[model samples]
Target chain A: MKINLKVWRQKNNKAKGELKDYKVDHVSPDMSFLEMFDVLNEDLITKGDDPIAFDHDCREGICGSCSMHINGRPHGPLAGVTTCQLHMRSFKDGDTIVVEPWRAGAFPVNKDLSVDRSAFDRIIAAGGFISVNTGNAQDANNLPIGKEAADEAFMSAACIGCGACVAACKNASAMLFVSAKVSQLSLLPQGQPEAKMRVMAMVNQMDAEGFGSCTNTGACSAECPKGIDLSNIARMNREFFSANLTGK
Target chain B: MNWISTFLKSSIGKKLLMGLTGLFLCTFLIVHLSGNLQLLKHDGGLAFNTYAVFMTTNPLIKFVSYGLYAIILFHAFWGLYLVMENKKARPVQYASYNGNANSNWSSRWMGVLGTIILAFLILHMWNFWAQYKFGTTPYTQYERNLATGKVTFSPFTGEIAGKMEKFVDTERNVEITQVKDLYAIVADGFKAWWLVIIYVISMAALSFHLVHGFSSAFQTLGVNHKKYNALIKNIGVWLFGIIIPILFAIMPIYFLLLN
Candidate 1:
């Protein structure tokens, strides 16, 4: 299948970007979106031009390293799948695809279809973990956590920190990502001691990163590859409210 | 004090304020719409006129009206501020953005919808509230037979009197009440085709705004749960979005075409 591409290109974060068009002929229907880009880059390199630079690590879709705003959606048109999981079969032959980096003040464009998502790292570093000792692995039943709580915590823990939520949100809000992190830890027995501090610090870090606030549009969750629920955000709001109310 | 200030400055706290103010305005809409529904009563504007007088003069409602005005201003300006900050969060927009892929147009265009509603509010207040309080609102007198419960009304074109006056005619077993005819102003205002069109269009915008705003307020306040989300969404869409706005739009249409 032949395809038309309008890909964003930038020299660096300080440089301006523009959509540069390229045509890829003889594309396979089974080729992943990133692999299709790889083929495009191969062609560009053969012509002595700069190959398009994008982020991709685990081609199997778990690393969350692949960040592409393809065809006006993060990770393309398909729901609950990363860019690496999106195949060319999703598009028609001779279709024109627009690929751009995740657009957010916190996630600056690094190059063509690549962005710096270290802001998420900073937010996580604020308080996304517990301070348990690492002497040995504890017994699975030692904690005696309820099944419902375990399931909910696992769901929140499924966030890949892909920055797709920010890309999808009109406000570029990181509430989904932040709330996922807050929920994953706050729902666990090990996460109860510093719950107040964790919520406050992580939220403060998120605000300091200059991300927009949540307007409850549900766009982020709709575009989320992991199907991260918006209820995590509501949970975070409850946590923050109770934390502040207790003056902790 | 310091923590409170810091909390309010945070993103979630800002949204909490938006939600609180938004839900308050939602309640005000219910009250305003219910009261305005009196416009459809076929009592020669007597019932509506009496309601207008009561709404303006009742002391508790008067105080609540002040609070309502303050809340509206805060909601509008604070919402504008949030929109501006949201714009700043993304300095460069995507060259090709199809927000409809992930979210509804109503959710994405809330700021624009809200601005339209604000503009409509100004026009609405000027047309009815200002005219009722200080403008040349006419007066009408209604006489009712105490025994039969039959009532009749006519224009009271005599000298200026208080907002309302009541007297009993024992000989004829009738009661008389005179009131400022604010309903006449409303009926006349809706008589203009352009005004009715604007009213209907503004209510359309209000419907879209509330469809997102209602359940969104609940989510912001941490009320989102699997068991209750569907119920909340249904009420938001049907009650606030469809019913209230349609009922409101019908008023102008009813006055223009039916009354």
Candidate 2:
């Protein structure tokens, strides 16, 4: 298959960016989107041109490092899948794919498609963890959490912090990401100790990080590669509301 | 003080304001629509005029009306703040943006839809609410004898003409006092095809706005439950989205076509 690619190119965060076009021929149908990018990079390197700089690791989609907006969608057109998992066959032989980075004030573009997602790290660091001291590994059944609570907690924990929710949100809100962290901790018994404090601190940090407010558009969860639910945001809202209503 | 400001300034806090205000406004819409539907009565606007007179004259309702006005302004301004903040959050635009793939069309175009509704609101208030309140138009006070069942329309030219607070409890009498005749104003307003078109278009935009906003405001306030989320969404999409807007739209069309 022959493909036309319009890839965004930028020198640095402060530099002006533009879409530069390239064509790749004889692309295999089964090749992953990143692999196809690899082919393009190889061709660019062979021609002594600057290769496209995109973040990717462990191409199996678990790392959450492969961050690129392929054809105006985060992680391409497939639902609940990463860009690294999107195969070339999703496009036709003569398709033109326009790729860009996550456009958000919090996640500034570092290079072509690599963005600085340190803001998410900072939000998590604000209160995304429990502050309990651990002596050793506890027994698995010691907690004895209900199946419903345990499953919901696990689902909330599935967020890989990919920033796709932010990328896909019209407001560029990190609510889905922040809420997932907030919900994951607030649902567990171990997390109950500082639940109120955790929600308040995390939400404050999310606002301080220059991210937009959630409008409940549900785009974040829809474009989320890991299928993180929007209910986590609602849970976080409940947590924050309760934390504020009652003293923490 | 610090906590209050902080909570109010936080993302979820701002959302809470938007949600609470939105829900309040949604309730106002249903009430407004039901009252407005009285324009369809065949009794020569008697029901609608009487209802309008009751609404504007009652003391408790007057206080609530002031709150309703404040809520409307609050909702609009707060929404503007959110929209501006979101725009700044994504200062750099995507070269080839496609917002529809991930979100509903109404969700993405809410700001636009809201702007349209705001424009319509300004025009509507100017035509009816402001004139009804402040305009020096003459009003005919209707006094009906409760036992005799005879109704009289007299030009109520006095301090009480403007503020008909005394007649708030006179439900038994068929005394028809012509206030600003808002029903005539609305019926006449719809006669102009362009004005009707504007209203129908605005209602359409409002419908789309409500479709996303009705459920979205609750979601922002974290009103999500496995059992009830679906129910709220259905009501938002069907009742507020389809029924209310369509009913509101039908008023103008009915007056235009029938009256």
Pick the lDDT winner.
Answer: 1
Q: How many steric clashes does model 1 contain?
A: 0
lDDT of 2 at B7: 84
**Pairs that collide, model 2:** B142-B176, B142-B177, B144-B175
What is residue A4's positional error in candidate 2, in angstroms? 0.7
Top DockQ model = 1
- CAPRI level of candidate 1: high
Task: After superposing candidate 2 on the true structure, give the runs of residues whose Cα lies further than 4 Å from its correct spot.
Answer: B136-180
- Report fnat in order of the candidates: 0.79, 0.86
Q: Which 10 consecutive residues of model 1 chain B have the lowest summed lDDT?
A: B157-166
B1-259: candidate 2 lDDT, tens digit per residue: 7778878888888889989999999999999999988888765565677788889889999999999989988888888878998899999988776788878999988888888988899998997888777875445466656678666555556555353433422676555454556666777778888888988899999999999999998888888888998999899999999999999999889989975
